[model samples]
Target: MCVEEQWLTPQGIVIGTLLGIVLHVRFSPDDQQVAVCAGNKIYMLSAKNEAILAELDGHLAPVTAAEFCTWEKSMLISVSEDRTFKARKL
Candidate 1:
């Protein structure tokens, strides 16, 4: 979902548990979703309920960072210890 500008204050924070080491967590541009970088995969999670939406697995090594593109609300980028940068649209 592409949101032009986010003006509303988030109602609450999302809290949950995840397996393995979590490298990074990035909120979607619209603040309705979350992308978690853990180990070799990116976990797409729901911001409202903290539920696992999907798992993005492509890197062969541990992921170092993940973020949502500010300009492209549906785009996500992840970097890995294997020296590769991946971009995906959610």
Candidate 2:
């Protein structure tokens, strides 16, 4: 994905990939990082280069949704079909 500023110059900011089936993705309020969920795991990546910063795994079933906490930039919430919700700090 590329991050671009809406201005006269339409230069794109190229970012790498997480290399998997991405189920969901959300960006933090600061816009410096992003949370990605794939299969049963969640990963935090740099929004600038898409580098993997952290990986979290706990759910037994496939993940359904992933969201970032507005109040906490380092906190992420995820829900799975295993009938469980997880709160993790990235």
Q: Estimate each model's TM-score.
A: 0.78, 0.75
Q: How close is candidate 2 to the true structure, as a TM-score?
A: 0.75
lDDT score for residue 72 of model 2: 83
The candidate that wins on TM-score is 1
Each candidate structure's count of clashing pairs: 0, 0
Candidate 1, lDDT over the whole model: 0.84
Best by lDDT: 1
* Candidate 1 structure quality by residue, lDDT tens digits, 40-88: 9988888889688889999999998998888988888999999999999
What TM-score number comes out for model 1?
A: 0.78
Q: What is the C-alpha lDDT profile of model 2 across 1-90, one tens digit per residue? A: 334544545357644354478778887888888777788887778898848888789999777788888788778899988999998877
lDDT of 1 at 74: 85
Question: How much lDDT does each candidate structure score?
Answer: 0.84, 0.79
Off by over 4 Å in 1: 1-15
